[model samples]
Target chain A: MRITLIGSGNVATHLGAAFKNAGHQIVQVYSPNLQNAALLAYHIKAEAIDDLQQINPNTEAFIISVKDDVIEGIAQQLAAHDKLILHTSGSTDISVLLKYNVKAGVFYPLQTFSRTKELNFWNVPLCLEGANENIFKIITELAQTVSNNVYPVNSAQRRVLHLAAVFACNFPNYLYSIAQGLLADNHLEFDMLKPLILETADKVQQQLPAAVQTGPAVRNDETTMNRHLEMLQNQPMLQQIYQLLSQGIIKMDKGTNGKA
Target chain B: MRITLIGSGNVATHLGAAFKNAGHQIVQVYSPNLQNAALLAYHIKAEAIDDLQQINPNTEAFIISVKDDVIEGIAQQLAAHDKLILHTSGSTDISVLLKYNVKAGVFYPLQTFSRTKELNFWNVPLCLEGANENIFKIITELAQTVSNNVYPVNSAQRRVLHLAAVFACNFPNYLYSIAQGLLADNHLEFDMLKPLILETADKVQQQLPAAVQTGPAVRNDETTMNRHLEMLQNQPMLQQIYQLLSQGIIKMDKGTNGKA
Candidate 1:
């Protein structure tokens, strides 16, 4: 299959390589920035194009891996092409591309991509959606070349997955930022918490998170909770986060909803 | 050094094994539950005692590795002895032992311990606090034999470290629980987020958490945020958490105060 990538950022860089590695021909790389386009194109042995008009009409598919807001505009620019068009966004609806293109779909790769780090593409899960049965089969084959786990999810389910990811990835990283702040303020090394962080993440694999949860709030140890709250008097936001998250955990333990 | 453990819980079990591995003698294992005491004692070749009266008076140090509330009571019960007394608690102050004995100190290991997991004791940070210089030196030597990182953290500093740990470890685990719930509700596998979770944690090592922060909140992408809020309408508690944490991240990015 021949594919053209419309962006050259982190997602584009990694996806371009994965597609190329899986024996697919990357026909072209398109980006407004010539340098970024050339950088990604050069690695994949594809031509770099800075103009939207230069997109190959003969290409099998066009993957718009740009920012969420820019995706709809790019789809409009390439509306005349009869090729299958897709965007790699978790939150954006698939219908955003329907008015602009005849055949549109989503190819959201559910993993964090950083230019500096090497990711095992096989382990990354690919969440996909398509406009029709024919396009869905094509997208599934393309996705399976790079990832072993391919999930067919609708816009609503994909939106929920993205929201859950923010909690799993973004919010926890924010808490780490707060932890780093606390340690640096007290002249302690950040590495001190590395083992604890690893262990905490590992525990969730075998058991439910709520079942394996442990801490002052989980135990309802008021003395320690009060001391932590008092210590965070200067930082009102962290204090509030501590109080709310603790309450959430306690509630989750009591609630019989999911496995938690 | 010859030591006697006053509890046979997670911390005591690990610490006792680490001490024995480091060529120190564990004189006895004491616990209210004789079964637990005998199990730990059997592994370390030590006597199991259910009564405080059976404590070995001549032991060099008594490590009261019990709950925060029980440390004071145990210290009081062993006050007649002249040996050094220590407690493995992060929130409890070093002064808890001062009212009872001649020498008192703290040996709080700054890592989450599980009875089922094998920990690399060498990497665990040992935060030591003592009542006097002599006692501090004795505890530091005992701590160094097992762990490579040992620090002299006062009670106030220790309390703050423990608080930071909750943010780094416990809070992140709670967010993971939320992530798990969202995925399970949508009929997605939790394993889908493991790679993202690992990368999020690994980013903090090379860069500060604030510097590497990503996602909709940091970008202030209102469209995605609004969509996520709508998806979470049924879960009011998760909705509140999402709003608060997203607001906190946005505020941290705006504030010039901490390293964040």
Candidate 2:
């Protein structure tokens, strides 16, 4: 497939290289900033363009990988083209693209992308949705070239996935930052918590998080919990988080038991 | 070293096997329940005793791996012995043992233990604190035999580590459960979130979490956050958590900038 990538962000940079590696021709890379477009295009062996009018008409598909707020504006500019248009967003609805282009679909990858880090694109779960079966097949085929895990997810389900990703990925990373802060305050190295964090993640790979849950909250050990609360009294935000998450764990356990 | 385990729970079971593998002698496994003690003792080739009075006198060390609240009570019973006594707890102070036994220390492994899961105990960080240098050396030697990562941490630092572990390990796990529940409610498999979760954890191994923080909150994309909050309107607890954690990430980012 001849692809034109819109936006030169982390997602675009990664997907551009991946598509090129998979033998797909990246015809052009477009960004409002010409320098950013040129840098990504240089790596992917594609032409760099700053203006939307300069997007290659010969391309079979256009992937809008910009921020959520700008996705609609980018899609509107490419509405005149008859080629398939896909946005690599987890939250934005497919209808946003449908409003402009008849050959609209979504090519959402369910993984966090970092410009500084290299990703094994093959393992990324590409959640693809199309305006029609033909477009869906095209996107799925294109997705399968770069990734092994591909699913047909609608906009509603994708929204739910985006929200869940925040809980599972984003929120946890914040908690880890909090832990790092707490360790730094006590003159301790963050390395001490790495093994435990890795093990907690590994547990979920084989078992449900609820079943594998450990610590004071799950044990209902109020003494330890109180000590922790008192220790965090100076940081009221952390104290509130500690209390709420503990309660959430207990409540979930009780709900599971009731169901059982 | 001939050691007697004072609890037959997950910690005692894993440590008992690890100690045996490290070529130390486990003299006895004790629990209030004889069956539990016998089960662990059988595996480690040790005697099983339910009564605290039946504890072997020939043991070189007594490792009390019981609940935090009962550590003092268990220490009180074994106070008459002049040999080393260690409690495997992250929160409890060494003073609890110092008040009883002369040779007192702490042997804390900073890892989540499960009865069904086999741990690579060699990688677990063993945090030790002794009443004196001599006692510290003894406990350190014992810890080194089982784990490669051992640290001589004081009581206050150990308490902080425990609190940090809750944030880094337990709280993140609860967030994972919440994600799992959200996916289930939306007819999505939890497996979809696994790659993202693993990557989130993997990022922290080499980078500071605050530096790698991603998502709507860190991006300050209030549009998506409001959408998520609306989606989670039914679950008030989850809604509150979403708000608090997002605020936390934003605040931390601001603090990091202010410092810079």
Candidate 3:
């Protein structure tokens, strides 16, 4: 399959490299900033372009992997050919592209990507949705070339997945930052919490998170909870976070108990 | 050294097995319920005792690996011999043991333990603090026998570490449960989010979370955030959590930027 990647961010770089490695021809790499496009294009042996009109018309699929808000504008600028047009966004609807092209689809890879890090693309879950049966089969076969885990998900399900991802990945990373800040203030090394963090994530791979919940909140150890709250008195925002998250854990536990 | 493990919970079982493997004798296993005591005792070839009076008089160290509130009562019951006494708690002060015994210390392994899972005790971080230099050396030597990573942490620092653990470990886990619930509500498998969860944790191993923060919150994408809040309108608690945590992330990013 001949593919053109539009965007030069983390997701674009990762997927471009992956598609190139899977024996697909990357016909062009497009970004408003040609320097950014060239850097990624240099690695994948693809032509880099700054203008939307410069995109290769001979390319079979054009994947727009820009920011969520920018997807619509980029899609509108692309010349409508009989070729497939897909956006690699989790939250945006498939309709965003449907307005511009009949062969519109979504090719969302469900994993966090960092440009500096190398990813094993084989394990990344690719959630794909196409505008029609013919379009879905095309994207699904193309996705299967890069990853073993591929699912045919609709726009509604992908939106829910994106919301859940914020809770699972983004929000939890913020909590870890808060923990690191607390340790730094107390003259403690953040290394102490690394093993625990890894283990907590590892546990969920084998068991449900609700079944494995542990802490002062789940145990109802008020003494420890109150002490933690008092210690954070100087930081009102942290104190509020502590109270709210703890209550959330307790409430979830009660809900689980009611079902049991 | 001969040790007696007081309590038959997750910590007690893991520590008891580790001590036995380290070429130390577990002289007795004690619990208020003899049946629970006998189960762990059978694994380590130790006598099981329900009454504190039945604890071996000649034991070198008594490890009280029970609940935080129960540690004091159990410590008070053990006959005060001129021997080391330790509690395996992250939040409780070493002073709790000091009130009952001249030889008091804290042997806190900063890891979440489950009775069904086997732990690699060699990697678990052992946070130790003693009432005096002599007691410190005794517990430190004992801890080194079990784990390679041992730190001499004071009560204040340990308290802060415990508080941080809740943020780094417990709260993130609850957020994972929330993600799981959201997925289940929409007929998606929890497996879809596991890779993202693991990758989020792995990112922190090499970089400070603040440096690597990514999401709508950090990106300041108000459009996506508003969409998420609207989707979560029926669940007020989740709505509150999403708003608070997103605000916290934004504030932290601002602080990092200000420092730069």
How would you encode candidate 2's per-residue C-alpha lDDT over A1-260 as one tens digit per residue?
Answer: 89999999999999999999999999999999999999999999999999998877999999999999898988888989888899999999999988874599999999988888887999899999999999899889889999999999999999999999999999998988888888888788888999888888888887888888889998888989999999989889889999999988777753441110
Clashing pairs in model 1, backbone N/Cα/C closer than 3 A? none
TM-score of chain A of each: 0.95, 0.96, 0.96
Task: Write candidate 1's Cα lDDT for B41-146 as tens digits.
Answer: 9999999999999988869999999989999999998888888889999999888889875589999999887787787999888999989888899999999999
Candidate 1 vs candidate 2, DockQ winner: 2
Q: What is the TM-score of chain B alone in each candidate?
A: 0.95, 0.96, 0.95
Candidate 2 clashes between residue pairs 3 or more apart in a chain or in different chains: none
Q: Where in model 1 is the C-alpha error above 4 Å?
A: A254-260, B254-260
| Clashing pairs counted in every model | 0, 0, 0
Per-candidate DockQ values are: 0.63, 0.64, 0.64
Cα shift from native, residue A150, model 1 (Å): 2.7
CA displacement after TM-score superposition, residue A228 of candidate 2 (Å): 1.5
Question: lDDT tens digits, residues B129-176, model 3?
Answer: 989998899899999999999999999999999999999999999999
Docking class of 1: medium
> How many clashing pairs in candidate 3?
0
| Alpha-carbon runs more than 4 Å astray in model 3 | A254-260, B254-260
Decoy 2 TM-score against native: 0.96
**How well is each residue in B205-241 modelled by candidate 2, as lDDT tens digits?**
8888888888999888899999999999999999999
lDDT of 3 at B143: 94
